[model samples]
Target: MHGEQMAEEFPVVGLDTDAREAAELLASQRLPGLIVADENGAPYTVLPASQVVRFLVPSYVQDDPSLARVIDESLADQVADKLAGVSVRALLPKELAELPVVNHDDTVLEIAAIMARLRCPLVAVVKDRKIIGAVSASRLLEVAMTPH
Candidate 1:
């Protein structure tokens, strides 16, 4: 399937969404990520589930895996506490990487390249300055592996 076809299966979120809410949506929907839109509802960025997890964990813990052992398992249940009042934009890299986006008519190959370069599980598909949908890495793989 092409990008627009694949995008129909995914969901979108706004840039102002709370980090904790986004995380919960990712978990509950079993999605790789969500398409983030600007106030105008134009596709802006891709927020991957991995990024959310990285945001929840302290940088020191991420830099040193051994430090994770010091925290009790119960800490996992308190992720919301750590993410309280944090917006999705705050969790994004401060350097401001370009948001990965593809046209609705873009080929699977193009979508794959964007996902690879961005290191994100999904890419936003847009038309007329609005998000049409999202193309997920897994969906691309499924199309690739299917018999032609």
Candidate 2:
């Protein structure tokens, strides 16, 4: 039930990485989320695919190819503009409820309770305030349904 026991290794992407690269990583890995980290590997925020999609297509803008061609015939500028000035930090979902981070010593039930109350699908595990892994809601469900 220890946090380490519940923790599952997840991918970490640098905050400064381009949105295109992040998109590729998520698509290639088939992960719903990736950890956002600083240059020194310090945790900053979590990037979910939902937010990435938002940056790609703004609600107000119609993705019309003809209009895009008129704006920038090459279309490179259009793509670049969608991601310009957008670091991982800026694109992260701000509606995240309390970020449930627990030490490796915490119990599974404790972590599960936090996730349930916060309605978060995952909880980041930390040691010395540095992220080590995550405990997903699915893992907690498995533990709960397993026979003791």
Candidate 3:
């Protein structure tokens, strides 16, 4: 099957979207990641759940994860405040990874290769440089595993 056949309607956010709202969407939907779009609504970058977790964790705690154990739950509750006025752009890494994308007609194997190579959980399926839909890693595996 091709990308268009496998792609599903997925949630997408823009670079200027509120980080808190994005995180809530991820949590509420239990998404592996959120697809981010540029000003033109084209595929930009993926904001993985893991990346959001990383952003929430204190830098010092990240440096020494054991410190996380000592931090009180109250502080943890307040930690979300950090994202209050932050934009999705602020949460993104300084050096961006290649956008995981596939053409509507790209073979399933091609989509798999891009997902594996980039370690991204979701890939945008585009037609004419605009996003049509997204294919998740689980969906790709499910399709690959199905008997022909």
Candidate 4:
């Protein structure tokens, strides 16, 4: 399958979108991640579910899993407060490893390679420098496992 065939339309979020709002969208949509678009609605970067979790959970909790056991219902709200004013861009690492991108006509194998290299959950499919859709890593695996 080609990228265009495998690509699934996902919601795009702006760089300035609040982390909490982005998290809500991901949860409500049951999406693996969301595409971060530039001012021109062009693909810029990806915000994977793992990245979101990392941003939400405190570092101490991540360092010691046992700390998570002490998190009560009330404390959960406090945890969410951390994301109140945080933007999507602020959650991203300063150095980007790669931007998983593929042309609409790219083969599934090609897309898979890019995704693997970048360790991204989704890859943007572009046509004429504009994002047309995206293919999740799960979709790429589905295509790979199918006997074409």
- Please name the candidate that would achieve the greatest lDDT relative to the true structure: 3
Q: lDDT tens digits, residues 11-75, model 3? A: 99999999999999999999999999999898899989999999999899999999989999999
List where candidate 3 sits over 4 angstroms from the true fold.
none
Local accuracy of candidate 1 as per-residue lDDT tens digits, 1-148: 5677777656777877888888888999888888888888887777878888888888989999899888888986786687788888876766756788998888889888888887888888887767877777877898888898
Question: Where does model 4 exceed 4 Å of error?
Answer: none
How far residue 66's Cα lies from its native spot in candidate 4, in Å, is 1.9
Q: Global lDDT of each model?
A: 0.81, 0.72, 0.93, 0.87
lDDT per residue as tens, model 4, 25-82? 9889889899999888888898888888898888998999898888897987687688
What lDDT does model 4 reach? 0.87
- Tens-place lDDT per residue, model 2, 25-96, is 878977766777778876665676766877675444455545534554455446536766566766766665
Clashing pairs in 1: none
Work out how many backbone clashes candidate 1 has: 0
Top-TM-score candidate index = 3
TM-score of 4: 0.92
2 versus 3: better lDDT goes to: 3
Give all TM-scores, in the order shown: 0.90, 0.70, 0.97, 0.92
